[model samples]
Target: MMDAALQALKQYFGYDRFRTGQDQIISRILNGQDTVGIMPTGGGKSLCYQIPALLFPGVTLVISPLISLMKDQVDALKDVGIQATFINSSLTFSETNERLSAAAQGIYKLVYIAPERLEVSGFVRILEHMHVSLVAIDEAHCISQWGHDFRPSYRAIPAMIDRFARRPAVVALTATATPRVTTDIRKLFGIEAEGVVATGFARDNLNFQVVRGQSADVFLLDYLRKNRDQPGIVYAATRKEVDRLYARLTQQGLAVGRYHAGLSEKERAASQEQFLYDDLTVLVATNAFGMGINKSNVRFVIHYNMPRNIEAYYQEAGRAGRDGEKSDCILLFAPQDIRLQKFFIDQSDMDETLKQAEYHKLEQMIGYCHTETCLQAYILRYFGERNPSGCGHCGNCLDTREKTDVTVNAQKVLSCVKRLRERYGKIMVAKVLAGASEQKLRSLHLDRLPTYGIMKEQTQKQIGEFIDFLTAEQYLVQQGGAYPVLALAERSLPVLKGEARVLKKGHIRAERLAVDDALFEVLKQVRKTLAQKEFVPPYIIFSDQSLREMSARLPATDHDFLMIKGVGQQKLEKYGHAFMQAIAGYQAEQKNAVN
Candidate 1:
């Protein structure tokens, strides 16, 4: 069975071997055991069920959550010569029935359906008649309320499975799952702890970064200009910001699109389609976008504001470098973004318990922005990894700016927060420290405080930023929601007593990732042309990683082309001649030019 799975993998998906957890997950599923797979965003989770689906005698049912995800996965499957289809709201009733009939006839080896479809008795009746061999649940974290993105509809899954006369093996998969959520999923699935297969949450190809105290627009424009040809996403916290950034980038004549809940469904679909098709080089969107997006060539994911938590941030950032190529994950943070996030938490419908949980997560995210330690290590520790080492490529690890000792400055700020009786926000604290003669300060008699004017040499903005830095480093705590007041933490006591020191690095600039070579560009154009001809995304035909390999190897024969990664027998048979001809033509051009 494992050998057959391996053959199916190379024959269709073009991979020579399984990724980290894929083999183990597939082995368990084939052996008829309920399994749970926890992998990073780009860790090839889809292949875990896909390989098994091909090897199984009966059809595989894939319970997906999103329409776009269902369509994308089905389309990719069909392109690779697999018989697959999706039943979702996008299809007409008759079209859905037609597909269901076909599924009943055992035509499709895999059928992707929305979780809601399982609720309809008619739909379940039809599925019951089919010889369902396995059930694969994607984004399984949605079933757990502890997960960041919880859906009550996922709760119906187990009951529906029990309705099956012959309970098929089950496998639940998710990209982001904390230990708490993992336990919830295991309990819901009735799978033992040993049944879980976690490949760890780490993307070596992604470079994590947090850019603070910089003009976000200026930094984004500069980064875009530097990597103008690369594909990327700019995520904002709200639809309004997405619109504003989209307009700005569009006005600059960049190939960009926008997606948010505020847009009509048609508008959102069009934008997503354009982005997936590579017609647009950049997408400006809110957190509502990029779930289950399988685009492999995204080179960067920049957050215009701080996300609500690290889980959301990591999943959004993981959208980049899915093709196992180098990519950047940048967060442009400001003090106001924290307030905005807090406001969101305050306005949410969550109960007090959940709200407090959200606040704690937000503080951890803030700590990530402020931490002087390795950025990737900070995230790993947050997700329950034990003593993770620093990733040398992340922003913090690559930072070469000289560190400046600011213990005295920190002590002054902590002392001011203490003097203010912890009743004021950071702005007021900064004003007092800068000796601003504002009427509010005078009316409150804050200017007369001993700590006032102690840091008067620095501007108010500098003082406020320092306070933000202190807050992020845990020296000071921001209490209350929407209108948080600065309070000293236990960590601040040592600083106030002059027992510990605070050091901050100078500003670091974003650098452009590597550029494509001439041959790679020529092949990319070929891919684009082919994609247009087929009316599919360019990456579906061949990923940039595959194109790079083609350029580097300059394969002259079918055998050599097959040796390149992502080139399976099916893709080789379908696309081999055109790509090989392009490579051959380029090589001939070089020879002729030399002659």
Candidate 2:
């Protein structure tokens, strides 16, 4: 069965073999056992079922909530020369009837349908004559109310499963689902899926970056200029932002388009067509846009603001680097951005308690962002899966200096929060810690606390970083609404009680202090030397940014410098001589042999 599945993988998906968790999921499906796949986004969740859909004896009914995703999957299957058709609102009555008749006649191997379509009176009757080998539910997370992106319509799928006379094995796939949500999916589907494949949620191919203190305009423009001609998607939190970004990009001579729920179907389809064909280089869109895009060449995925949940972030970010190329996942963050989301949550129709719960969920997402450890690792750990080793590929790992034990700082910050009884948001707490004699601090009487100015030696940025560090470590999560509040996580009981040591520096990089002044002077020389050798601008050869990174890494060989990102062939070759000169000069001056 494994051999056959592997053959299908190569024959259709054009891969030599399955990715990390794909084979195991396919194996279980082929053995006729129910399975739940909790793979991360960009983790190849489709092949787990698609390969099995081919390996099985009869037709596979794929239940996909996103009509656009259904259409894309069916299109991909057809492109690979497999027999497939999807029944959705986009189909004409005649077209829909034709596909259903073909499924009745067993002409298609995979039949796609939205749950609403499947639950229609005559739809199951049409399916009754077909050979139903397996039931695969994509975006299976929607079956639960508590899921981050829930669709009440998905609850109708189990009825279709029971409608079939000869039972087909149930298979579920989702990029995001907590262990609790996973169990809910199993129980709701009437499947006892145990030890189901939940691949470690880590993408070593992506360099994860969460940049704070940057305005959206600055971040987007600088990022786009740095990576011109590359395919990427920029997700905005609102329709207004999308429109503004699209207009700005267009004015700057970029091929750009805007997508949102307000657009007409024809407009949406046209924008999507333009994007997929590479007629447009960038998509400034809201969250509703990516379900249909299966473009594998997207080199970057940037969020103009925070996503409401980790699941949504994973799904959007997963769209990049599908071809297994090196890619970037950048999140442009601001402290008030969370407050905007909190305001949205508070103004919703939900009652006070449920509204409060949703607000907390957003805060958890913010903490996830500031995490010093591997973003992928933190996400996977949150979903109740564990990796024995760090990913060693994400931003936290590849950053210039590994974060050091700031836990002591975090404890002090948390102490301040506790001392204030979770009354203040990050700003007020920051003021208190910096021992600000400002009028606001005096008014709040926060200056009187013994812990106030306890960390006076640290800069405000350092102290803010420590507090953000606590958010990342999850000892403290933003809480309440309006003014915004801070509260302890479920795991924070012991931390708050001082019984458990809070882990700091959620980063994977080993700590390396900044270079000594002598080394800095030598690096400056290296930059000047490289600038003269390369006929181009020195900044083009090696931006102060790139040089700073190299100085911190101290690459000993040409190969190491080449491996330093942004050292493309052009820069590497043109400036290689000067870089070599710098290394030689340093070695001679110090009388040390080259390592």
Candidate 3:
């Protein structure tokens, strides 16, 4: 079974070897063990089930959360000549029935279904007639209440599995899962000891940053202008922000698209299609975007606001650098983002316990934003994993921070908060310190305080940022309510008494991660043309990583081309000639120039 799975991997999926955790998960599944794979994004979780689906004698059932996700995976599978189909709300009743009929007739080697379909009697009855050798659950974290995106429909999966005549081997997969979530999935799936597989969550190719105290619009425009040619996503907190950023970027002459729930379905689809086709270099979206996106060449993912939790941010930011190239994952944070997230938590349907849990998670995200430690290590630790002492690739680890002693400045802010009796939020505090003549300040008689205007030289943004840093460092605490108040934490005493020094990272220009290679550009054009001709995503044809390898190696023969990482037997046969021709032409030109 292992050998056959490997053969299928080469022939169908176009890979030379299994990625970390895939081989173990696949082997465990092939041995008929209930398995749980907790892999990070870009960890090739699909191939674990896909390889076994080919090796299994009966059809493999894949339970996915989104139609777009199923369609993307099934389309990629069918492109490699695998028989795969998905049944979901996107299909008409007749179309769904026909596909179910095909599945029963053994027309598809794998069938993808949304978890909600498990509760449908008709869907279950149809599945009962088919031989399902394995059940693969994508986004399996949804089954646990502790998970970031819990779905009640996912809970029905166990009952659906019991309805099968012969219980198929179960394999649950998720990109982000805490130890609790991992245990929940295992218990839910009846996976036994040693049945869990996981890879490190740290993505070395990704450089993480938290860009606070900057104008999000100005900073975004500057970053985009510098990295204009790169494909990226800008994630905002709300649809209004998405639209606002979209309009601004569009007016600025950047090739940008927008995605959010407020947009018409057709508009969202069109925007997603444009981004997938490389027609749009920047996609400004809310958290609603990127759940099912499989685009591999995204060079950056910038969060306009910090997400409510680390899980969501990691998954969203993981969308970038999927091709194993260096990419930026930046969060343009503000203290108000905490309030925004709290507002969302308050509006949620979850009970008080769950809401409190969510708030705790939000606090963790806040900690991440305020942490001076390695960003990657902090994230890894959040996910219940560990990494080396220093990543050296993140904003903090880059050591480019211009540290300034803000001890005196910090005392003034803390003292100001105390003098006001901690009755206000960051903006008001910043304003009071900056001596902004606001009517509210006059009404409150805040200008009478001796601490007022002590830091008048600092801008509002700078003062707000100092408060955020203090809040993060526990020198100040932001109360959570309808209107948040600022209060001093126990740690504030040291700064107030001059017993401890306070330092903050000054503005450091982020290092641009663009690799300029003429040959790479030429190969990309060839890939684009081929993808257009074939009517597939360019990354599906060849990832940026593959193209870079091709450009570097300048493979002249089919055998040499096959040596490239992403080139499998089927892709080599389908695309070997054109790539070889391009490489040969470039090599000849270089030789001629040298002569």
Q: Highest TM-score among the candidates is held by which one?
A: 3
lDDT of 2 by residue, 1-595 (tens): 8988866665554356677888788888888888888886667887777888887777899888777777666765654568998998888999999998888777888988887776576877777778899999998988986677778778878887888889898899987788778889988987776746888767777777787533457657767876666668999999988888888988887778889988898998888867765567788899898876566667788898898777778778888776555778888775556767867786677777767667777767887777777777777776777564567877667666434554466667777888898888877788788887898888878899977988888777667666665664556777766677776567667665667765433333211112345654566566655445532223334433455556567666767766654454444555555665676676677775543
lDDT for each of the candidates?
0.89, 0.73, 0.88
Ten-residue segment with the worst summed lDDT in candidate 3? 504-513
Task: Please tell me which model should have the higher lDDT, number 1 or number 3.
Answer: 1
lDDT of 2: 0.73
The TM-score ranking, best first, is 3, 1, 2
Q: Give the clash count for each candidate.
A: 0, 7, 0
Better of 1 and 2 by TM-score: 1
TM-score of 3: 0.92
The estimated TM-scores of all candidates read 0.90, 0.68, 0.92
* Residue runs of model 3 more than 4 Å from their true location after superposition: 386-389, 415-489, 591-595
| Stronger candidate by TM-score (2 vs 3) | 3
| Local accuracy of candidate 3 as per-residue lDDT tens digits, 1-595 | 7888888887776577788889999999999999999888888888889888888887999999988888888878877788999999999999998998888888898999999998888778889889899999999999999999999999999988999889999999999999999999989878875888888788989999888755567778889998988999999999998988999999999999999999999999999999998989999999888887789999999999999999999999999998898899999887678878989998989999999999999989998987889999999888887554679879888766567897888899999999888888889899999998888888989888887788888899888867877775678877867678999999888788879998876665655569789889888888999889988878888899999999888888878888887888778888889989988888889899999
User: Model 2, stretches more than 4 Å misplaced?
Assistant: 193-195, 350-356, 387-389, 401-595
